[model samples]
Target: LIISSDSRIPSCGNSTLTGLDGDFVRRSKWTQLIPNTTEATAAAEAAGSSRAAGFMRLTSHRVTIQGANSATLQVNSGQMKMGMTYGFHLQVFNIYRGSNVGNSKETFLVSVKTEPVIAQIRGGDDRLLPIGSLTESKILIDASLSTDPANSTAKLNYNWLLSLSSGPTINTSSLQSLATEQMFFTTVPFLYLNKSSLISDSVYHLFLNVTSRRRGGKAVSSTSQVLRTTSTAVPVVSVLGGGIVNEAIPITLTLSTSSPSPTATYLWECTSQNLILTDPTTRSTSLDSQNLQILPSVLNGGATYTFQASVTIGGATGSASTTVIVNAGPVSGSCGGSPEVGEGLKTYFLLGCTGWSDQDTPMLFKFSTFSPTSTLELSSYSQLSSITTLLPARPSNTTIISSIQDSLGATSSFMFSLQVSQPDTFDVQDTRDLIKIRLTEGDSSLASVLISGTASYVFSNRSIQNTSQQASTVSGLVSLVDSLLNSSVSTTEAQVSTPLSLLQTVTSGPVSSLTTSTQGAVLSIVERTINSSLNSFSNAVASSTLGVLGNVL
Candidate 1:
C-alpha cells in the first residue's frame, strides 16, 4: 500500500503487511490513503519474501521530527464499532532516511486510551488502544487492551520512543499520526474485537482523522472520512415441510433481519438431485401455474430436495432456505374404458367434485380381474388414483374395461384401447398396420358398422399416413327415401322428349344467365309434365293424395 498527502509530507515509497486475517476483522469496505494501494494488490505484495515494503504501504500516515517533534493519529468511532470494544493496533517497520531537518531522535505519541464523546456520535481519537505500556517500541494490542476515551474520564494519549542511533529508527508513531510532514514506512494494524459483541445488521457511516502531539504541546488533524460496519444483515431462507415426492403440502418461509425496515420478496429454490428444472434463470419463487404446474407423471424416486427463498427490503436483503428428503410413491396409469373388456383390464373417470378428502388425495381401487399377461395402469385424463402397470413402454397386448362412480351415485361405463401392435406381427422387410380405439361409451345392442372408408389422410415430411385412422367417420348421412325423392326431381328422369328437352333448357343455363323467354318456356313445359306424371302416378297409387289434389286445384 502507498500513502500520499497534498500537504508537506513527502510521498514515501510503498510498504505491505502479511499474516493479517482480513475476514475475521470486519466486513466494512476499506480505502487506502494512498490511491495506489488496494486490498488485492496489497495482499499479493505482502505475501512476497520481502516484508519491509508491505509494512510501509499498509500504514500510510507517519511522522518523523526532531527530539520534541511528536504526532497523534485519531481513529474515530465512525471508522470503527460504536459500542463494541476494539483494539486499534499498528506495526512499526521498514524505516528510511527522513527528508525533514530535525533532531536525530524523533519521539511520537498515540492515544492508548479512550477520550470523551467529542462529536454528536463518539469519535475515534478518543478510543485508541495503547501499545506495549505506551513507552515501549513496536507493540501489538486488541481494542480492549487500552481504555476507551469515549467512555473514560482520562484523555486519550500514547508516546512512541524511537532510537535514531541506527541509520534511522523505524517511525512507528507515523502509523497513527495525522501530520504527514515526513515519510515513514509502517503498517496500520486493523482494529478487531478482543471479544465479539452483537451488532445489528445495518449501514453505518463514519470517517478517520490524523493528529500529532508535539513537544510544543500543539496538535494537528487530517481530512479523511471512513465508513464502519455497524452491523451486517445475512440472507436466510426457511422451508416448512420435509419435502415429500409427489406429495402436495403447504410450504411457508420466514426471514430474520438486523434493520427493522428491510424491503424484500421471497425466492423458492428446489435443489433436488432429480431432474428438476435445471435452468437457474427460469427458476423462481412465484407459485403461478407456469412455475408450479407439476404433472402427476414426473415424480420417480427418493431424492434430496432444498429450496431457498430470498427477499430484498430497503436495500437490505435476507434469504431463508431448508433441505428435506423427497420420497416417491407408486406409479399408476389408466387401464381401459367403456365395456372395459378383455381378459383383464379396467378403467375409471373423474367424478368432478368441489373438494377431496385427505384420504382421497391418494385414492386406491381394486381391479375386477387380474391379467396374467397385462397390468393395471392409471390414465391421467380419468383422474383415478393408485393406477399400476408393469410395462415401461406401451404393451403389445394391452386392454382394459372399467366403470366409474360419482359422488351422487351415478355410474358410468368406459373402455381402454388395446395396444395396436402384436409381438410377431412385423419383421424388418414386412409392414403391418393396426388401428386402436378406446370407447368410453357403447351400446352393445347396436350392430358394428365398418366406417373405415371415411378415413382421411394427411401428408407431412414427404410421408402420407392416416392421422385419424381410428375415427373413420363420415360428415353427413342421407336416408334411402330422401334419396329416391331427389332423383325424381332431376331433369335426367323426364319421360316425354319435349318435357325432357324443355327441362334441359331450364336447367342447362346458369340461374343468373337465363333470359326471361327461356325461363318462361321452361316453366310452361315443367307444369304440363308435372300434371301428366301426377295423374298417372296417382292412378297407380289411388289411395295416396296425389291425383285428387292436382285435379281439385
Candidate 2:
C-alpha cells in the first residue's frame, strides 16, 4: 500500500502484493482495512448525505513504483535522516519486498547527499541599504538559527554564495566552478553588495550552505528559498498611510525607503500648523521616528498638508516631500495597482489609502505572508503610503493586507491576493544610463581610495630584497625599478583581477559581455568624461531607456 507522500522508499511496481497475502494483509487478516475514499464517498452518497467528501481520501493501500518519483511530495529538511543520502538512483535495480531494499547494485550506485541540517537565515526584513563605503554596507547573516538535528554542538562550515539573481533555490549547476576560499564563511557571516554596480535595478543575494566538518565538508544542507538583500539607495524616501483624516480618524504617516540605513538618521517634519502633530518632535534615528501620528482635528473639509523627510546616509544626504489631504471622513483603500509584478523587480507602490473615497491602493497593496520563513523576498511594508519594495524573486500567490483608519481610531483593513509571476528569461542589456557615480562626500585622496575599499598584500622582502640583496649595484637599481613596476596596482587591487573573470563567467550575456564590468568602469570613465559638466550627470539620471544611451551621452 503506497501512501504516496509519506512513502519511505521508492515503489517497485510489483503486482504480487495485490494478489497474494503479504505480511501486512496476513497480520490484520484484512479485517481492519481502511476503506478507499471513493467507495466511502459512494456509500455516503447512496446514504443520502450531501457532503461531496472533497479532496481528502482514506485508504490503507500503498503505492509502489520503479525508482524514486515525486508526484506531489516535496522533500523538506525535517523528514530526511541525518547521514543518509536521499535522491533518485534509477540505474540501481534489485528485487525488494514491499518497497523495502533487498540488495544494492554496487555498479549502479551513485552518491547522493541530502541536507545534513536545516539551514535557516534570519536577520530582519529585506534591507534598506545597498553596498557602499560604510560600516552599514554589510549585514550579519545568522546561521546559528540553522539547526543540526543530530548534533547541535558539531562544528559546521559555512559557504556563503553571492548572486544577482535571487532564486532562493539550489541551482548551482548553472553557476561556474565553485571558487576558492574568498566565499567560504565561518560562524556568523557578513555579506556586502553594491546595487549601483548593476546596469539595472538588480537585487543582490546572500545564502550559505551549512556543511558538516565531520562529513568531509560536503554541503548537506543549504539555505534556500530566501533572498535577504535589497537595493534601496539611501536619501530617497516616500510617505504613506495617510489620506483624509477627520478629528475621529487619525492618519498615521510613515516615511520609508528601499533599504533602511541604520547609520542614516532621518528627520520627518510637517509644515501644516493647523493639524495637531502627535509627538511634535522630529524623527531621526529609529523606525518609530519615521512615523508621525496626526490628528486632523482642525480640518473641516479637506486641507492639503506637506510632509518632508530628510536622511543622511554615508556621505550622501537627501530630502523628499509628499503631501496628504486631511479631512473629516472615512479612509478609502484599494490594492493600489500592478496587481502583478515579476519576481525580483523593484516596484513602487502608491499610497494604500488614496483620497476620501475608495480605490487608491498600489503594488504595496499586494503583499503575501509566506509561512515558515520569509524566503520569498517579500519586502516588509505597511499599506498606508507610497513605498519602494523589491518584488519577491520566487513566483507565489501573495496576500496583501490593506487597511486605513482615521483619527477616531476607526480601522479599515482588507486582505487581497497578488500574483507574483514567474520571471521571464532576462534579455541582457547595458543600462549605464541608470548608473551614476556620485562620489560620497568624503576624502577621495589617492591613498585613501586605494587602501580603504579593499586590502593590498605584498611580501616585504619582494619589494626591497630584490634591490638590496642583489649581487651588484646595477642589479640592485634594476631590481628597484622592477619592484616599482610590480607595485603598479595598490595593495588591495591585487585580489580584484581574479574575481572579474570568475564573476563574468558565472553571469549572463551582457554581464558576460563585460557590461557589468564596463558599467562600473564606465561610471568612472563617464565621471571623468563629464567631470566639467556636473549637469550631465543629473541629465543622465533623468534619462529613460528608449534604446539609446542619451542620458549616458
Candidate 3:
C-alpha cells in the first residue's frame, strides 16, 4: 500500500507528532491507497522529489518578521529529518520491479508544524545629551545612537527639536534635518536662532528623538533627556562728562552700561600725558563708584587727560573713552635798585618782573629825576622786564624815582639817590692858563715897576679856603682891592700883600706916585686872579660862597 499528502499544508503548519495508537485511528487523513504496485511506486517517487525542492527553497531565501518586539529568523543550508513514534503510520513501497526494488523504495512519512519567522526591533538606550553654550546665533546638535547586539543590522534616524518653554510642545518653525550615508548612525544638526527672536534672561530646552529601524521592520523611537541652552549678550560701556578740565578744579565723570546681567562689573581708568592713574581715591586722578574725579592738580594747567570705562557681562567685555582739555589763568611777581648810586653812572631797574598772564605782553616804565628836572619813558617791546638808563650829572645830591607798569595795569615803584662830591684841591691851573692880560705904562721906568706874576695861585689862607663850611672868598677880596685902590692905594697894599703873597707877588711903584696906566693895569690883574680862584670850587657848595665871602670882606 502507498500514501500521498499535500506538502504545502505541512510546510505552513506545525509538524509535531506523538505516537501511532488509537490517536492515529481517530485522526482524519487524505490518502490514496493504491492496489496496483506499479502506480503506488510512481506516486511515492514524485512526492519525494517535491519535498526536496521545498527544502531547497527555504535554504536559498532570507526571511523577515515585522513587529514592535520580535526575534530574528535564520535557516541553515542543510536538510532536517522529521521523526514520529505514534502520530503517523508509514508504508513501505517498491517503486521499481525486480532487481532495483529496495533502492528506489519510498519509506519515511512525517508530520510537522512551524511558525512564521520574525525580525526583532531594538531602540537605542535612553540617555542625557550634552549641549554646548550658545555664543552665536547658530549651534550644533551632535548625538549618537546605539543598539543591542541582537539588532546589529538596525539603522538609526535622529530628529532634533527645540522649545523656548519647558513643555512637550516643540517649535518646528525653524526645525532642521541632517542627512548622512547609509552606514552612519550619528547626526550633527545645526540649530539657528536670532537673538532678537529669543527672550532675554530666559532658559530654553532641547530634545533629541532617535528612531531605529531595520529593513522591512517597524520603527522604534527613543528620546533623550532635556538639555539646557546658554545664551548671553555682551556688555556695552559709555562714559559721561569727559572733556577739558582746569587744574585745581574737581571734575566728575560717570561710567554706565547697557547690560542687565547681575554679574556685570565696571572699571574706570584715566590717562593724561602718558601717565596712568592707578589709585582713584587718594590721588588727584581717581575713580569711585564708576565716577571719576580729576582734581585740579591732576589737570596741571594746560594738559589733556583721557578717561576710559570698561564693563564686563558674562565673560564679555566692552570699553569706551573720552578726552578733556585744561586751561590755566594769569599769574603775578617785582624788580628794583639800591638806595644810593653814583652820578654820571648807569642804574638799572629790572622791568623783567613776573606777575603777568600766561600770554605775552609789553611792559612800560616811567623815570623821574629830581635834579635837572626831567621825565623819561622806557618800554620793553617783548616780555622782557629789565630797563637800563644813565643817571644824569647833578650839581647836588639828587634823587631818581621810576615806576614800572605791565600790560595788565599792574604798577611797581623804585627809587635811588645820586651824590656829587667836590675835588680834593680847588686848583685853578687850567683856568689861569686860559686867561691872558697885558698892561701899558709910561716908557720912563714904569715898565720895571709893572711886575708880571703867574695867574695860577694856591690860596692857602684858611679864612678864604674853607671847603666844608663855605667856598673860597676870592671874589670878595677882588672887590676889597678895587675899593682900597680908589680910596687909599697904600692901604689896599697892606691888606692884599698878606694873602696875595701867599698866591703871587706883585712889585709895583709907590702907590701915591704910580702912573694912572700902571694903577689901572695892576688893579685889573688882581681882580682877574681872585675871580679865577673862586670859580675852581665845586658847584655843589658854590652857591653859599657869596654870603661867606661878604662876611669876610
Candidate 4:
C-alpha cells in the first residue's frame, strides 16, 4: 500500500490523516498467504502498525503565532540585535485516529511558512526603544529518512513542524527624544523557557530591530536587540530631572516621580553661556559661582528674578525646580542734621536750591529733632518768621518821618547801640523770640521800625558794646560829610542830639549786606556773653547775663 500526506492544515486547526490500499495490495497479499497461526500474527502486527502510523500522522501538525503582532512593542535593553529567534511549540493529539474511512497505516507530510506580518504600529513621541528578538517556524521532514531505524518513516512522515517559543516583548510607544538636559529609559519582557516542554535542552535566540526618530523626523538610529539573557532585571531610565537655586530668594523646588520609593535621586541640568566650572559627571546640573550671588543686573529695576536647580545621587538623577527674587537697598541723599547750642551750628546744608530760596533774607533753616513742639522746638536764624517770599531782609514794618528830635537826636547817617538791663529775659524764650530786636526811629520809644525776626539781631540791645571812641569817629565822619555837603552848621545839633562820644559802633564798616552784617555783629556779642559765663551758668541754676548786655547795649 502507498500513502501520501497533506500539509494545508493550520498549526492550531484540526487535521487528520487517511490511508488507501490499492488492487496491488490484494494481489500481493493473495500470493503471500500463509498458515493460520502465522497469518493471524501478521494480521495482528499489521493492525498494531497501522494504528501507530495513523496516530503519528494525525498528530504531527505544529503552529506558532506571535504573542504581539507587527504592532510596535516595548522592551527594555541597552542595544538591539537581529537574526536571533525564539518560539513556542504546540503539542497535538489525534482525536479521530480510529475512524474507518482509511487504514491507520498511513504516511503524511507537513510544512510551515511565514505569514506576512502587517505594518508596524505607530509610536508616539517620548516612546522608548524596544529590545529582544524575533521568532519563525517551519515544518520539519521525515524522521524516518534518517539512518537510524529507531526513528522510522512512520515516526517522521506526519505533519509535525519545528516549533519555537515566543520572542521578547518591548515598548512601542511614548518614545523620548535625546536633548540637552534630558535622558531616556524603558522596560522590556522577553521569552522565558517553558520547563514543561518534552525537550528541555532547547534554547532560542531573540533578535529585534530598533528605529528611532526625533519628534517630527525620520529614524536616526536603527539596530537589533542585543542578547541580555545573562543580565538581571533591566530598568528603563529617563532624563527628566532638573533643579534651580535662586539665591536672591529662598530656595524651593518641586519633585516628580516615575515610581514611588523611600528615596530617589532626581536629576536637573542648567546651561549658562559663560561657565565658571564644569563637572564631568551629573550633566544634569552645572552651577557657576556667579549664579550663587544675586546680582542686581539679573533683576529688573532691582526687582525679583527666577531660575532652576538640578539634583542627583550616586548615578541616577532626579530634578526639582524653584524661583528666586532679588531685593534692593535704600536710596541716599543729604536729608538733614542735628542742632548746636546758643550759636546755631550749620545743620543740613542742602545744595542746588532744593526748590527753595532765601526770601528777602537768607533762608531761615529751622532745627528740631524728629518731632517738634511749637516755636520752642523749631528755631530759625535768617528772619522770615512767616512770609514765604524769597526776598532778603524784607522790612516787616517801616516808619518814616520828616524830622525827629529827642534826648538822643538823629542825624542823616545815624549809628548807635542801646543796652538793655534785663538780658536774661530772653532766656527760655521761644525760637521765634530768641533774636527779636526792635528798631526805634529815634531815642524816643514812640517812633520805630519793624524788621523780620530773622534779622532782629542787628538791633538787639543786648549786643551793644561800650566803645564811644569808635562811635565818635563815625559821628565825626557823618558831621564832616554833612558840613561838606551843606555849609550851614547848627550849634543846637550838639545839645539836641545825643553826644557822639556816648555812642559806640558795634560793627565794623564796609560790611556786605548791612542787614546780615549788623545781625552778625550783634550775634557775636551775644555769643561772647554766653561763652564768658558758660562755667558760671552751669554752676548756678539761674543766672542773669543782663549786666553784660545792659552795660554794652
Candidate 5:
C-alpha cells in the first residue's frame, strides 16, 4: 500500500507549510496516518474471533518517504494468507503534529483492506479426496471449511468454478482466462459435486470465489482458493439381487459395471454349505430349488446365505454382497391322519393333529375329495384348526388330497383314502319311530346311550331344552356313533354277525350327559307316540296266528 501526499497541502489543522521544488519532509516529520476505522480492521477482528489463531496479518509495516511530498506505506503478508482486496476508501489524509487522527496516537490502520472472505476446500473425510472410492463411483467436494471475517450475519456468496486441465499453474491476476468448464453459486459455505461431473485419470482445478458486503454497505471483501482433486476417477461396478424366498425355491443374481476393461473378469461365491452356486465363474449365477430345511442335528440350520460378486473394471477390482432369506417349508405332522368317515350328515372330525409352517406365521389347509357326488361341508375356510370338520353326504371311496399352506404360498401336500360307508336308508318319519321304539321299548335299552361319547362335547356348547332340541341332538349323536364305530360297515364276513362288537366306543361309559329329567322327557315322547301302534300290532300278531311274527320282530 502506498500513501502519496500532493504537492499542495490539501487540508489540515497545522500551519499551511507548502512544499516547493525539491523539498520533502523527513520520515519523523511525516505525521500522516490512516485511522483504524477501515474495513480491514473489522476483518482482522472477525478473523481472530472465528478461528483459534490469526488469519489476517501484516508481517511488515514500514513507511518510506520517496519524494519531497509523497510517501509509500508497505504491508506484506505471511505464507498462509493469500487473496487481495483493493480500491476501497482507507481515510488517508494529511496530518500535522498537533492534529492526530484519533484521541490516541497508537492506532494507525493498515493502508490495505485485504479482503476478509477466505475460501477453503476439503473432501468428505476432512482431507482433499476423490473420496467415495472406485466401486460406488462417487466424489465429494466440500467448501464448508472456508472463512468469512465479516459480522456473523453477513452473507458470503460462494461461487465455485471447475476447470479441466493438464496440471497448469494458476495466475491470480488473469483468472478470467482459467477457462473453467462448470460454474455455479451456493449461499452456504459448503457444497459437493458427484463423479459424473469428473472423469478418471484426468486433471482438474477447482476455484471458489466468495464475496460479501459489510460495514453498512461501506466495505466489501471478496476472496478465493484453488481446491485439490485427484487425477483418477472412481471405478464403477454394481451387484444386484437377493430377496425373501421359501425353502426349495430357486435364486438368481447378476453382476454389472459401466467402466469395463479388456482385463475385466467376474467371480461369484456363496459361504453357505447348503447353497450350490451354478455358473460361479460367470456374471450370472443361480441356486436351484435346494431344500433349505436343515435337520436339527445340522449346525445353524442353513436358513440364510450370503452371495458375493466380484468384478474388475479399468484394472480395479471391487466386490459387493447381499443376503438371501430362506424360510423353512412347513412341516406336516403326519401324511394326513387316517380318520374314519361316514355319510349323511356325518362330519369327519380330523382326529389327530394340525400342520404348521412356522411359529410366527399362521397355517392354512385345503382339501380335495375326488368324488363327484359328495360335497364337503367344511367347518371353516380350511385354515389349520383343531376342530376342522368335513361333511361328505354320500358314501364313496375318496382319494383325499390334502395340503397345508402358509402365508408365503409354500405348501406340503399328502394323499389319503377315506372310505365313506353309506348310512342306513331311512325316512325321517321311520327314523323317528325306530329310534323311539329302540330307546323306550326295544330289547336293547338305550335311553342313556344317545348323549354319550363325542356328542357330550358337542352338546356342551349347545342349548338343548325341549323335545325338538333333543331330537336334533340325537341325529348328531347317531352320526358320531357311526363315524366312531364305522357302523354302517357291511360285508366284513359277507354276512350279518353278532352286534355286541359294534358301538363299543360310542357309548361314553354307561351314562348320558343330559339331566335325568331331560332323559325321561326324551324317552316319554318316544314311547307315547309308539305305544298304541305297538299294542295294536301285538293283538294282530296274537290273534292272526301269523307265526311269521318272529321274523318281523
Candidate 6:
C-alpha cells in the first residue's frame, strides 16, 4: 500500500487539528501474494531442515473517504512505508507490506481560512466628537475593530493607522504622508493626538484606520467616522501689586485676565511666614474671589510671601504668581542726659539720640527745664539731630527733663539740672581810695564811684579827738567826706582845708601844723573855732564853713 500527504490542506479551510476527521482514508493499491515451494524449502533448509514448508499469505483492506472537500482530514496507517508528493491536489496515502501492518502511522490535516475580515470598528466613548469644544491639549482615541466569526482559528495581525485632516474632505495623499502607525494584538487600539500640532481657531478631523491581516492571506481594513477637533480660548491671568512692603501695612492684590471666559472659576492662594487665613471654600490658604486682602500681621517682618492666582474655564486653566517682600518697622532709639544744670550759664542738655533708620521718618524731640522754666519741641531729619537743648539762665540749679518720640511711637526720657551761683561781694577800700583822690584834687564834682575788684567791707564808728565838741566836729566832718565820696562829684582836700581855715579864724586860735596823725585834730579844732566865731563875727565864717560841709554832705 502507498500513502501520500498534503501540506496545503490547513490553509484552505477553517478547521483545527482536534476537529479533523481522523477516519477518512484513501487507498491506491492492495497487497499481492505468490506461493513458491522450492523457495520455501530453500528458506527452510537455510533455517534448519526442521522448518516445514510455509505458504504465502494475502490480506485485503479497504479505506473510505468522508465529509466534503472543504473539511479537514486525518489518516492512520499500521506500519506503512510513506512517500509524500506535493502537487495541485493535496494527496496523503501510504504503501505498506502486509506483514508489517501492525505498526502505526498517523497524519492530521487542519483546514484554516487565513483571510482576516474586519467587519466594523468600535470607537470607544473617549473618541473626539464634533459636538463640543476641546479644552485639553491632548486627546485619546480608543478604537476597537472587530472581525467577523468571533471564533475563527486564524492568527491575525492588526495595525492602527491614525491621520489628521483640517477639513471635511480627507486628502488620502496628505494622510498617507502624515499618518501615525502602530501594531496591536487585539481588536482594541489606542491613539493619541496633540492639539498643538493642529491650527488654532480651526477644526481638525481625525481618521482611524484598522488594518487586520493573517499570514499568506489578504489584509482587511476599516475606517472610523470623521472625528472633528475643536478648540477653546485659553484664559490669561495676571497679578498686580507685588514687591517690597512694610509690616503692618495693608497689602492688596488683584487678579486680572487678558481674555475673559464665561464659565471661568477663580482661586487665589497665598503662603507666608507665620500667617494663616481662613476660607469658606477651602480650609487652607485659598480664596475664591479675584481680589485678595492681606491685613497687617498677615505677613511677618523680614519675610517673603508668595501668591498664586489660577483661573479655570472649560477644563482649561491659566495661572499667574507674584511675591511680596515684607520689611521691618523703624527701630527704637535712646534718650538720656546728666542730672544737674548750672544757672547764669549756657548749658547744653542732651534731649535724645538714635541710630540710623532704614526709612526716612522724622523724629520728635522735646525739652523742658524747671527753676527758670522753659519748654521746646522740634522735628529732626538726620539720624541724630536737635539732640541738645540750651538753657540760658535760672535762679538756681535745677533739673532739666527731656523726651523723644519716634514715628513708630517709641519714646525715651532724660533729666538734668541747672545750677545757679551766689551773688558777688562788694569792694570798699577801692572806693575809699577813689574818694581820697577826688578830695585831694579839690574836684567837688567827683561824687559816686564804681568800686570793683576784690575788696568788700563795712565801716564802723571810731573817736577822732578828745574833747566832746571836737569829737562831734570830727564825726560830722567824716560823715560829710563819706557823703562826698558817695555822691557823683570830685572833691579836693584844699576844698576841705578852706572850710577849716574859716573855722580857725572864728575860734581865734593859733593854726596847728597838720600832720597825717593829727589831721583829725585840725578838723576838730576848726569846728570848735567856727562855733565860737558864730557869736563873735555874727556867723559870717561859721555860715561859710557850715555851708561847705552841707554842700559836700
Give lDDT: candidate 2, residue 103: 30
Cα shift from native, residue 377, model 2 (Å): 48
Total backbone collisions, model 3: 25
Kindly give the number of clashing pairs for every candidate.
Answer: 70, 32, 25, 68, 2, 47
Q: Candidate 6 — worst ten consecutive residues by lDDT sum?
A: 451-460
TM-score of 1: 0.21
| TM-score winner, 4 or 6 | 6
> Please, what are the lDDT tens digits per residue for candidate 2 over residues 1-553?
1111111223459866545334331110011113444534444354343322321232333323322333222233223333342222122222244543333211111112333465655422232333332234233444455656455576666777766564234345422222322455665433333333322334446567876654434446875423323334445455555443444444576777654778877776555554444454322233337766654343344466656666677866545454455443344445443435433333333213344332221123223223122211122233334333433232346545454544333345555555543233321111111111111322112112112111100111112323222223222222222222233233211212211111121121121222333334423432333333322332222221111132122
lDDT of 2 at 243: 42
Q: Per-prediction TM-score, please?
A: 0.21, 0.21, 0.21, 0.16, 0.29, 0.25
Candidate 5 residue lDDT tens string, 1-553: 2232212234345554344212332232233222243544554454466531222333232334333222323333231122322212222333455353321111233323334554544321112233345443444444554555433455677777666565545444334333232336777766545544444344556656766664334333333333344444534434455544555444555566556566666766665545555534322323221112222222222266666556655655555454555655467454443356554224344522343434223456555443332212122224433333443332346555566666565566566775554334423344334444544452121211222212332333232334454445544444433232232223211011111111211222224433444344433332332342323333322322222111112
User: What tens digits encode model 4's per-residue C-alpha lDDT throughout 198-222?
Assistant: 1222222222222232223322211
The lDDT leader among the candidates is 6
Superpose all Cα atoms of candidate 4 onto the true structure and report the RMSD in Å to 1 decimal: 51.6
What RMSD does model 6 have?
Answer: 58.1
Report residue 302 deviation for candidate 5 (angstroms): 5.5
Model 5 whole-model lDDT (C-alpha atoms)? 0.39
What overall lDDT, based on C-alpha atoms, would model 3 receive against the true structure?
Answer: 0.36
Model 4: weakest 10-residue lDDT segment is 368-377
Model 1 residue 325 lDDT score: 38
Task: After superposing candidate 2 on the true structure, give the runs of residues whose Cα lies further than 4 Å from its correct spot.
Answer: 1-116, 132-142, 166-181, 184-200, 213-219, 224-553
Q: Which tens-of-lDDT digit does each residue in 491-532 have in candidate 1?
A: 322222212321231132123333444345444544545565
